[model samples]
Target: MKEKDGISECPEQQVILYVEKEDGKYEAMQTGSYISANYLDDYFLKRGTLEKALGEKIARGEINAIEYYMILEDLTISELAARAGIMKWTVRRHLKPGNFSNISESALKKYSIVFNITVKEIVTRQSGNRN
Candidate 1:
């Protein structure tokens, strides 16, 4: 993933601060500054965790690759279908664990292309439980 230089702020950003006067009284002051969040690492960490969990689930046969892509990969059924060049119903059907083993090699290839992984890797690589 490409690194971003923090968040971009809109032109009308504003902030308020309290100022202490000579009499020890507080006064309100308005200032304009850009606020940015440096959470890219945290975001990637959480996404990695989710990917691991999804891989484990797929390995355990608790969920199929379709479900893993839909949940962990954050893709909608229609989007996945379009990427795979298949119908949404076909994608939904493949989401069933029982139907996963019946997926055609061509369809598997399409899914591998969409996920940017090899067919063998997608089928065999299992991120087993850590413990």
Candidate 2:
């Protein structure tokens, strides 16, 4: 029986796959795959939980909009700063709620590109935080 490009070897099995660069063309190429639903589920759950916490922090005058952007992008402070083309210290400073009002539109634009979201979304994420 023939299998589809993204399908597993059997219906009973599921996997996350990547194309392996073998010597053959499309149909003959093999996939490097793994089964890790538990891992993926746990990771997504942690992200959701963390986002909820971050939202509360934003509401409570602890962290700022930067924390939301960073969580959504799954980026570290250094990575976010790098993507924004700014200093890490700048990013750190922006993480505080007190400094958010002073953030420039240009800087928000940079973060918008990194997070693949619009500046409006960054500034005012709605409840449930769905993008």
lDDT against the true structure, each candidate: 0.69, 0.69
When summed lDDT is taken over every stretch of 10 residues in candidate 1, the lowest stretch is 1-10
> TM-scores, in order shown?
0.61, 0.63
- C-alpha root-mean-square deviation, candidate 1: 10.2
lDDT of 2 by residue, 1-131 (tens): 22344443433345544443343433443433324422556767888898888787777776777787687677999998988898999988888777876889998888788888888887786323322
RMSD of each: 10.2, 6.8
Clashing pairs in 2: none
lDDT assessment of candidate 2: 0.69
| Per-candidate clash tally | 0, 0
Candidate 1: the clashing residue pairs are none
